[model samples]
Target: MRLGPDTLGTLPAEIAQCGYDRAGQAIGVVHFGIGAFHRAHQAWYLDRAMAAGERDWAISALTLRSPTVAEQLGPQDGLYSLTERAGAGERTRVIGAVREVLFARPDAERAIERVAAPECRIVSFTVTEKGYCRAESGGLDLERAQESFYPVLSAALAQRAARGQAGVTLLSCDNLAGNGAVLHGLVREWLAAHSPDTLAWFEANCTSPSTMVDRIVPRTTEADLQALEERLGLEDRGAVFTERFSQWVIEDDFAARRPRWEELGVQMVADVAPYEAAKLRMLNGAHSLLAYCGLRAGHTYVHEAAGDPALRQLAERLMVDEAMPTLDPAPGQDLAAYARDLLTRFADPALRHRLDQIAMDGTQKIPQRWLDTAAWHCARGQAPGAIREAFDAWCWHLADARFVDDPEAKRLVRAASGGGRQTLLDACFGGGAGAPLWPEYAHLRPLFEGRRGGS
Candidate 1:
């Protein structure tokens, strides 16, 4: 049987399911960018929260640029399965946190109206790093911002303000450091330029809490879907699979009604920067290193490369020697333990996390992942060899890889031309007059250029 409200009785008895009636919940949250990660992590949490009796936080998921998720889940009444795997064991649960789904392309106005609704107390999104439409200087890309989600969001805020509706919290679930604050600035910048009135109202009312979200949600494949069908004896078009590990550290700031997320395992803290910095550098940075360098060495998935002795050494060196020195975690937080967990997580063979997926948007990711740490090390008179090697791998990935999916791919490819290490670095760094560099940059070039076995 196909999964939907009508097929609820047909759901497998062994499958963990939501106990709450979907009709009992109101749409208190609207999540933009209904991708697999959002479904597996955020929606999964909300589903558990509602099932555990936090009934006021049902979600209405929206996809801005694509109708793919809506097309798949709408027929099922926004119900989908989240299969969490660890080693050979897996748990499947039907999620009903997303009570409604919207495709922004055809129903843009309705989406805006939903955001403006008084019932929608929280508006969160998982638009990837590039979806923010940030410029080279890390601010709002003015031209792109005009054509991006910011305008629609700004209009929604305008509608709310005009209707005298209460302001809502805007949470960003993307992997970017200081994601909420960054999103707040982008919205403020866009509104300051486009609608001053909305800007004034938003400044006085809304809150954007910075968040650090972690989960390994690989893109679903046909094989995964087929296996899920076999195991469950039902057709679930919106099924998503992810690793057993999941985390959400949010700065305790909210303008409206906050979901009882503490009951559902979300870490609400006084400060999120320390955690955010740690994850971005230690976990995400190492992932980038593995992606570019690993793929160049003929590995397809993260586990394949992370399991390799040479690649594992490189990752360890990058995290411990290069990345960790730049981070200062909270008093009780264990940075060393976190580093150990990152490697273990990456090496999970069950989760086929693709290097190419992690490698996308290299330009946007580099500033936070490697460049910032490299700059920090340089200011302290450190060499930062591992970071430089990663950059070299990134350049090579651009020049030689079968596919490059960066917005700046054309420019990066041009800059990656064969002259030497400096030429490639200069091109990748955009030929800036005062570009950041490590003391041992020159020495690091040959290692990457030679495609040496290890870091």
Candidate 2:
């Protein structure tokens, strides 16, 4: 049956709440960084958990940044829509797993105390790679701009440890190699820096389960809401749309209880390394390549980039030629096939994932995706042409006076290499630059210059 947007848009049978589930149970999980991806992925998994007789998995989604989502879900009785589209067709599901919502901005201390409750057994994060407060070299990045997230997350954990809330698993749902270890270091640094006494308790009690999550969650748009509303025959105050494929791999590090995520397509294994590395290099690394090279060249979405013969060829060459060398073969699965799948998914004509969306926070993401790739090429005595080309293009993107001046841009902005886009090549290529794609792979100029350089 269809429900108007006024009466809380219709949810599929699996996620629909009868009188009791609608009444809401106690909150067992607290999620930081409440964005569309988390709602579409993790909370959706929780909804499945509740439907399968695991009623204690209710989530209290906390927004560590803005009150926007907290405000939207709080008043809507903690219900939202998960809209999935395959081509022109769509499926809408209402999620009832979120029991409560709160913003940390106005009341940071209270927000921590609330989640530190002894019953809140799970503390998960989807704060993206930038949120973990990491350095380009993959440690606790305690720079001027990144201090807030770590200190804030640590403060909350310290409070929890103090309340003897020792049994919670701190799960990180970000895309980074060894994300759990990275966050663990940041949290340890935070506790030592501030609450030394609580450091022992947290160190002894908490578990940061490393995870590898894969999904192409394009930014939500008005069209998503309108299409979903049309399907449900009403206005949806909260609707999140994403592509069909989803994956999660956990390192199985939990000492205390954790969600039964494995029951919902999540892989729990001794080591999530190979799967994570394969995906990161082939999937996310390619995304960064496309964003710098694709978007700079006037491509708006990933599909367009994939469709471009020259760009796609370059993307494939890097993933197979440059990236594949460093990685162990993706066991049981064709690594080439996986790269092809990633290309096809990114090229989804229906998804319309923006290049600009992929392009953001490059200051943080580049060190991991591109710089690391450059290092690999440098070791082989190869020029990082494609990688350097992307870096040069990124420098152009960063070179903008307005963008360069921003606090986040500080790390990326340096004195211009004096030799122009090609010079940063030396610094990045010999290790990050000095690649063949430049001076040799000349086709890069058109890709890097784009219309901005000229018409």
Candidate 3:
């Protein structure tokens, strides 16, 4: 059993010694939401940068939701495992890129200090789409009190305003359209309430650079833990495993020093809008569809769902026909290659991506996943059959039903369904379900008022 850092590996104290050689403190980026994905992806990229002797980019990992991660990681000298799983088996690698870790559980006061740290030049986030505390109009919503919700950027800018420190770039690596603008609005709202002067500093000196991060980080199960324990002969309480594929794209705009992240496979571009839209509409949207409909179709896990001949073809066709044509071309992205790679990653049996895990928060997720594209197609006089199928599946799944794994979403689902498809469509879309949309979407109303997952 791994009792401490001695059993896991050497403590990461060396990385924080300001050992950037020439760059002094090196890159001081504060990354929020310390989850398994950020550990395997962003932290790995920083490790690669450090190994290549590209000093100056060290990360301060911050957790806003859970305190367990902070407790476990802080003592082990900020130690964790990044096990890479592929077709063959699992390979274990220790990640030590995080020089420090902080918690924002109870409040944002201290968390804001870390983000506003003078040495902390770039503040990045893996806080996901819902964390920005934004409303439908893409402005800050003060009453964001959900589990995943937090006023992170808002508080950070307030700290900057009070300290007279400005000009720190805000980077959002979540999956959202124009994530920068989303974050910018959240920060601006906090500024308007707390410090309007600071908002000016942010606008003049800082920039919210939009970014898109893609990877398949499945839940690390007990089976994965057992496999890693045997392979390394070391027990890690926080060991996380993932399929072997990753990607990151950033719209290059920064106020202070940042890592040459492009040095290690990260693509820097003029704008990430097209790419973000493509991934959001196709990749993430499809993931949601498969998580619900695929499971109802009798598939157990994400791998099982992808391996299904019918479901696999459904995914490919949805991407090729319904999803791809809706978005413009990315600079260096090969749509065909990207789609193929996503399938391979999703199909990895060992990863065992949980169906319910993706299914949770459907109330918050479906707007972006299935509804947005469906509404767009409706306006263009086109029918979004595949997406509607997904919407219907989601509405059905929300009935405290066993479509995936969300009790909370299941409770809220009745608000959409229970009555009829038109009623559900009315609830999900409101006045803007599009003009021609309700008619095409009404085709599925009968199903919603009926039982779900009969097949």
Candidate closest to the true structure, highest lDDT: 1
What is the lDDT, from 0 to 100, of the residue 154 in candidate 2? Answer: 68
Among these predictions, the greatest TM-score belongs to 1
Residue 284, candidate 3: alpha-carbon lDDT:
87
Of 1 and 2, which scores higher on lDDT? 1
Worst lDDT run of 10 residues, candidate 2, spans 446-455
Off by over 4 Å in 2: 1-6, 9-22, 135-152, 399-407, 410-419, 422-455
Q: Of the candidates numbered 1 and 2, which has the greater TM-score value?
A: 1
Q: Rate the local accuracy (lDDT) of all candidates.
A: 0.84, 0.69, 0.69
Per-residue lDDT for 151-187 in model 1, tens only? 7788899999998888999999888888988999999
lDDT of 2 by residue, 8-41 (tens): 5244454344233645577778888888889889
Error of 3 at 454 (Å): 10
By summed lDDT, the worst window of 10 consecutive residues in model 1 runs over 436-445
How would you encode candidate 3's per-residue C-alpha lDDT over 1-455 as one tens digit per residue?
Answer: 56244563332332222123322434377788878888878888887777677665677777877777777677655656776778877656676677667777654566666776777787778886667666556566666633442455556765776777756888888777888888777776767765666667777778888988887788777777786666666666666777667889888888876778887889989989888887887888889878887767767698898888877887777677777777788667778787887788788887778887887766556656665676666667777667756765666565436554432443345544465544455554353333322243443343333433321
Error of 3 at 50 (Å): 1.6
Residue 220's lDDT within candidate 2 is 81
**Backbone clashes in each candidate structure, one number apiece?**
0, 10, 6
